[model samples]
Target chain A: MKLELGKLTIRDIRFSEESKISEGILYVSKEDLRRVALTEEKIKSADFDIARPGESVRITPVKDVVEPRVKTEGPGGIFPGFIAGVDTVGSGKTLALKGMAVVTTGPIVNFQEGVIDMSGPGADYTPFSKLLNLCVICEPVDNCEKHQYESALRMAGLKIASFVAGLGKDIAPEETETFETPDLLTGMKAFPELPRVAYVQMLQSQGLLHDTYVYGVDAKKILPTVLYPTESMDGAILSGNCVSACDKNPTYIHENNPIVEDLFKQHGKTINFVAHVITNENVFLADKERSSNQTAKLCKMLGLDAVIISEEGFGNPDTDLIMNCKKIEAEGIKTVIVTDEYAGRDGKSQSLADADKAADALVTAGNANQLVRLPKLDKVIGTMDYISKIAGSSDKALQSDGSIEVEIQVITGATSEVGFHTLSAR
Target chain B: MKELTILTNNPSLKESLTQKYPYLRCGIEYRDVNFLKLLELVRDEVHKGARILTHPLDGSVKPMETPYKSILVEKSDPGLDLNSLDLIENAIMSCRKFHFDERELQPRVIKDFQIIDRTLMESAIDTSGLY
Candidate 1:
């Protein structure tokens, strides 16, 4: 299959009489975006706010962040299964809003909703800080179930992103990048001498607030499966979970996975970049065993010389990461695993809940336990009520000085597992 | 009854602990792991109340009859999923942050041994008082 990505560099976003893109500036209509978000009755009401670079703004209880993109020429549109039909996307032309993100925020479902500070020392760890964030804050109707409310909020982010991407539907892209993945035999034939590489991406599927969706189906219900590298960029997989703020793969990260982008850069040159495997991190032990066993089997069947395995969330998933690494390496396939650390506040505790000597080629995405003090911003998007009770915080987090002390994990996308950000420890 | 939970991530800490604190009775270890059992303890002397025991890993074990059955989860307030939520909580709980530039992870394990010493001393006092 083949996919061509047309990049529409979005330099700025503002409210306008009508929604459209001109000179790389996206003029979004509040009524239009809110209308799309409130389509789901689960969301009591929705509103739009903007946070830009260098702004003294903070968005809190952030549920998910999604990049706006649309398929200009394809069998399916962007976010194929959920936004559009299951038409098997990633085979045609697609347009993307390059620099802006649709960030969803609302009531804290669990203590896992993250914080995205637009500026300050706090912004250094979060990747979303650099993007022009169109913040959507939603409130659930009285007494909506936590998971139901989370589902509504998750879809709202995707819908708003889709709505904004529609503004540039007809605009010509400034640059286009094409990606193609032929059948196994054809790809091997083309790069027979290159090392065959594959990517094993784990999805957070512990259920409740920790979940991921593929083609609108809950990932926890699915077995390990293979995907085309382009499909994920086209929104084949999405973040539908409220996992701990730091390491969870938010929808924005999935839409523009750095490892996928990096692997493609090396695709035809040094490595074959043969396949992409999607696996789940279920809570049950049997599920972990089954998934890891099958993942190793897939690697062996593909004749992969090496593979990169990236995990989502942490703890239980660490076992999955190690199991996959050990099993795959035991099959004679070299493996590199990407993960984050929880080496305690003092950086003196063991980082992982599980570990093995087999995991030699490991990449740490900083210590989530590392602390950061975020200066109070001039304006806050979400409520401060959740600040103290949030996962990384105790009642003492919001201090008398109004400066909040928190771990980098409280900031959204701080220690991304896929090398998504520059924040890493020695 | 007072209880002591061993808090350590060292796998060898469990083995070394049995030899280090011979008087301390062993209890169930709770880890987030799916395994049924992690260690074994056979006792010739059963002491009543205020047990000092340790199960030094991440997961939580099932509740047992003894008061000291809580594993690393209950022993430490550092949070359950060490790599994600716990990392965030512990870092914030410290109030102040410090960087560790040392390449060695030896300090963390060494500190766990010290904890074992202090906890065992307290348990020894409690066990002897039962007379």
Candidate 2:
């Protein structure tokens, strides 16, 4: 399949009389945009706000960050399966709004959400601080269930993103790049002399609030299977998880996955970029073993020399990481795993809950348990009333002086295992 | 009374332990014993009801923490038979393994493996508990 991803770098975002893009500035009609999210009966109230880079703003209880993009010339629409109907995508042209994100806020399930600081010492630890965030704060109707609230907030974010991206469909793209992958037989035949490399991408599929969706299907039901590299590139996978603010891959990261981009960068020059082996991190031990066993068997059958396995969450998923590594290495295939650490406040405890000598080639994405003091921002977009009860905070988190103490885990995408950020520990 | 078995290969250290932790005065008994002899004693004690036993392990290593165990094993001689001590004797399989299909660069190469995958895991000496 072939996909041409067009990019338009957004320099500024502002609310105006009508939504349009001009001179790299995105003007949004707040009333019209708010209408898109408020259509859902579960959402009681909806509002649109923009958080610029280097602003004195703090967004709390963030659910997901989505990049606005429209499928201009594809077989299926953007974000196919969730907002768009389930149809084969990633074969034609898709336009992505560069340098900005649609951040969804209003964590009705208080502790399950994350924080985003547009500027501060806290901002330095997160990637979202660098983007021009168009945050959508939505409140669920009275007595809404946590699951219903999560969906309400998630759909609101995607609806806003889809509405904004549709505006860029007819505009001239600033840049365009094409990516293509051949069938298994052809890929092997073309790069007969190069080493075969594939990616074993583990999806966060534990359950309930901690879930990820693929083609609008729950990831927990999926066994180990193969995917074209471009499938994830065109919004085939999305995050619906409330696992941890720092480590969970938001919908934005899944669409612009760094591993997929970097591996494709070395497609034929250094290695034969093969297919992606997708698997789930189920809660059951038997499910973990079965998924990993199937993943390893596929790697061996594909004649892959090596694979890069990237994980989504921490704790229970660490076992799945080791199992995939050990079982794959047992088939004479070298594997490297990407993951983060939760080594305690002192940074002296064991990093992972599981380990194996077979998992030797490993890269850590920093320790999420490190504490930091977030200075008060001039403007707070979401409420700070629930800060003390959050996972990374204590009763003393909200100080009298207006500042708060919290672990980096409270910050969105602070310690991503997909090598998305620069923070790491020795 | 709990028997404090000192499984030591040094005679002077044994003498030092016996002198340092003297009986009746400290309300405890110290016995000098070999490593194999301690295993035989443990096997005999297993048949009888053992009680109120405690052994302080090295704080650095916790075996249970790493369930899929990987340890550094030295090339040593075979151990004593404990069937005579009323213990069920399982047949000894080959302890030397190459579960990784690794090519050896030199003789007597040391390779690490997850303990459960190793043939001798059931019989493997989990010395972490014994120090």
lDDT of each: 0.72, 0.71
Instruction: Give the runs in model 2 whose Cα sits over 4 Å from its true position.
Output: A424-426, B1-131
Writing each residue's lDDT as its tens digit, candidate 2 over B18-91 gives 35335412112223443234333444443453311211110011112111221111111134323222211100
lDDT of 1 by residue, A174-239 (tens): 999988888899998999899999999999876556668888777877889989899888899998
lDDT of 2 by residue, A1-426 (tens): 889999999999999999999999999999988799997779998888999989999998788999999999868887778888888887899999999999998755445568889998988888889999998988889988666888888888888999999999999799998988889899988999999999999998765566788888878778888888888877888988865788889999999998998999999999998988899876544567789999999999999999999988775577688889999999999999999877766777667656789999998898777889999899988888666645456556777889998878788888888877758554
TM-score of each: 0.78, 0.76
TM-score of B-chain for each predicted structure, in order: 0.29, 0.26
How far residue A194's Cα lies from its native spot in candidate 2, in Å, is 1.1
Candidate that would win on DockQ = 1
